[model samples]
Target: MEDETMSNTSEKIAENVLLLAVARLSMALSLPALGFVAYLLNLNLEQKFQAQENKIVAQKESSDRQANLTTARVETVERVAQSAIDQAGKVNERLISVETKQTQESAASERFQAATLTRLDRLQDSIVGQSNAISALTATLQADQDRNRPPPP
Candidate 1:
């Protein structure tokens, strides 16, 4: 009877030790799982941060490009406006020059016409005087002929 009691007590002690070992093993496995979960969370956070950074960089680049395009368009418009203004100035100058030349030419032509008319009037007067002289000379010659003619026989 004593030997059977001793064997039963030893069996109970072995079961208690097994229970303790199981609890210790479960705790070890839980630690590794928790660490793995924490690593995954850190990785997800890093990915989100990196994506946001990339978006910000892209936005900056887009803004810079837009600014450059606007500046270029403005410069082109300014150049065109300046060119138009320069062309207008040149046209104005040309018009003034043309008007001056036309006025000068008109004035010179009037003087020339006046001189020509004066010369024509002088020529007409000289022609009239010469015709009168020729008529006088012809009359003298006829008188001499009459005197010199012999009487009709």
Candidate 2:
């Protein structure tokens, strides 16, 4: 009876040890699989982070380019407006110059017309004086001829 009881107690101890060993083996074997899954998750997370960073960089570059383009366009518009203003001023100056010239020509023409009219009046007076002198000479010649007649009836 003492030998059977000792044998039964040893058998129960062996069974408990076997069960504990099997549980430990399963836990150990699952470590690599869990580690592999964790590694894949970490790799995916790193790739996503890099992709987000790349997107942010691209957006910054695009915004910078757009700002530069807007600046260039504004500058161009300003230059064109300045040029137009300059051209308009030049045209106005030319128009003023033309108007001044026209006024000067009109005055000069008026003066020339006045001078011509004065000259014509003087010419008419001279011609009248010459005709009077011719008439006086003819009358003197006719009187002398009468005074020198032979008195023959």
Candidate 3:
């Protein structure tokens, strides 16, 4: 009975020691495993942040390009409108000049016509006076020739 008791006591001690060693080993390994998991999560979060930043940068560049194009388009339209206005003003000026010249020419033509009519009236009066003088001369010559003639039987 004494031998059996001693053997049972030794066996219980060995089993307890084995269980304590397994617990210690697992604790040591779990600490490193947890640290490794944390490191992996940090790396994944950094990669996600970098990708978001790149996407934001690309969007900003595209917006800037669109703004530049819109500005250029607006400027071009303004220049075209200004040029059209300038051309219209020049055309109006030329039209006014032509009208003024036409009015002056019309006035000159009227003055010339009036002067020509006055000259024609004076010429007609002179020709009528010359015709009356010629008639008087012919009657006097006939009277003289009749006085100079000899009587005939």
Against the reference, the lDDT scores of all candidates come to: 0.58, 0.59, 0.57
Off by over 4 Å in 1: 1-8, 82-153
Candidate 2: list runs displaced more than 4 Å. 1-80
- Model 1 worst lDDT window (10 residues): 144-153
Candidate 2 per-residue C-alpha lDDT over 88-131 given as tens digits, one digit per residue, 9 for 90 to 100? 55555655565565556556656755765576566556645655
Judging by lDDT, tell me the better candidate of 1 and 3.
1
Model 3 has an lDDT value of 0.57
Question: Which candidate, 2 or 3, has the higher lDDT?
Answer: 2
Model 1's alpha-carbon lDDT is 0.58
Kindly give the number of clashing pairs for every candidate: 0, 0, 0
Question: Candidate 1 or 2, higher TM-score?
Answer: 2
C-alpha positional error of residue 119 in candidate 3 after TM-score superposition, expressed in Å: 99
User: What is model 2's C-alpha RMSD?
Assistant: 68.0
What shift in Å separates residue 8 of candidate 2 from its native position after superposition? 99
Q: Report the backbone clash tally of model 2.
A: 0
